[model samples]
Target chain A: MIFPPDSLEAIIFNALSETVESMVFEEVVINQFVANKWPQVENSAWWACIELFPPPISGEVIIVVPDALMNRFTEATLGMGDEPPLAEENADALGELLNTLCGRLLAMRVGPTHTFRMGLPKIGRGDTMTQEGNNHKLVDCLVEDDHIYLVVPNQFWDFNAD
Target chain B: MLKILIADDSKTARMIIQRCLEMVGVANCEYVHASDGIEALTIMRAGGVDLLITDLNMPNLDGKGLLLAVKSSPKLTNTPVIVISSLVNQALEIELNSLGVNSIINKPVSPVKLLECMESIMEKGFIS
Candidate 1:
């Protein structure tokens, strides 16, 4: 996966734009992102990631963002009111938002000639860890200041406790 | 024959873009697909991609990184890119355009409007 980065950014940025329109309507920016993860790496609190798979046989696109940003995202996504259910409600909304983003990405990529099904959304705890594998490409991005991490792989890896 | 590559994580988006480009009457045109920014780059690297359309937020490389990477490449020097999105940041948009994006298509896109956009940039041979 050592291709130029623009095309990949277009995929994520375009998907992020479309996903928000169909789902929540929160216009966002595709902020700059990097690959390494700390020490000799570059992971941060805003990191988010996802994996894509079969029929499509691709991988997922994972994304991460700060908690405060996630909170705002939940409010924007659910369109909740004064009675919004607090942190619990935000969690549910976050999962749904990511799910919608993934589903939209696959359908767009495969075109009318193919269809891909997405599994239920799993929200990673800020500290989730990822393993390396082939047939997979990782995408990291930011939306309106929220850090987003993603992956498109042929199979599902072990789920961390996030 | 102008070659166009559309990279997005959304299926609906791809359709909308395809329909829009058709409406613009871009004849003898080619449309390529990439699920994420990373794949988009891969497709472009293979050649014949004259215009690159992408979103800002995506898995793997995301939009900004993608834009930077593409512009940074010597091979893609002549290729033009269009940034279309709904991400809630204006500064990012300004930055992208300033960095040399040919145009910016704000979100909530439709077949009709997209077509109109294409028409704005239509050249002589795109239509019969």
Candidate 2:
């Protein structure tokens, strides 16, 4: 199906913008939409993933933040001065952040009450997963000129299963 | 008053939703926040939301998982649901229907559309 691409981009940006501004206390412009290729299986670079299982339908959302950026996000988001919270140690918070951002995008698409069940956010530096679904695609965004990579899995949701 | 819940992994998302809702004249409504599916369910378990406005992808439980949980839960079964996502899958829409989702709205949500959705759901909520 042909989804509304521009609105989708706006949704992604709207969500990120709010979060970024709150954390940094300054508004940030989400840069133009960029697309990149991603993997399905797990990989070694530290990454955070949010899974949305829409019943018989399922999709994968991955956010790969370079170790350094992850640190900056936590610091800026949490208003950390320095010697900031470690991404590994702050996995829960980071996971929550990614999940929220992803949720905004999904909310606009799936509608309220049509939410997927969130799982415990996983944090690992290495163990690359490189696979792509027909529905799977990539969205590259620049927040405050900071690049953020997102993977939107193109998985066909099975509506027939009861 | 419209009872709305914004469930997403991002604080940014919640804020956006909140602003959109307000911009759409969703005033005097009680808005709640959930970090993930679990938190969303926790709120519902205690006493469900009249309408669930959420994202498909999230942490602690993605949007789809949350839908399943709601469908399975006797208390939250009737709660209206809406999904927002960057990836809109036709097949996934079918799957959501199987799960009994009331509606599916694609992402980059606008204040105008959100009002339409809320109005429709509110009308339905009142009927039942």
Query: Candidate 1: misplaced stretches above 4 Å?
Result: A1-162, B119-128
Evaluate residue A154 in candidate 1 and report its C-alpha lDDT on the 0 to 100 scale: 30
Q: Candidate 1: lDDT of B89?
A: 36
> What does candidate 1's lDDT look like per residue over B6-106, in tens digits?
88765445655776667556657878888688999898888888778887656787777788889889998557677766442344445666777766675
Model 2 spans with C-alpha error above 4 angstroms: A1-162, B125-128
Docking class for model 1 is incorrect
True contacts kept of 2: 0.11
Residue B45 lDDT (model 2): 84
For model 1 chain A, where is the 10-residue window of minimal lDDT?
A: A153-162
Q: For residues A113-144, what per-residue lDDT tens digits would candidate 1 score against the true structure?
A: 45344444455454464555454444555556
Error of 2 at B1 (Å): 3.6
Cα displacement (Å) at residue A61, model 2: 9.7
The 10-residue segment with the lowest total lDDT in model 1 chain B: B119-128
What tens-digit string does per-residue lDDT give for candidate 2 at A96-129? Answer: 5665566555544455435344444555554554
Model 2 interface CAPRI class: incorrect
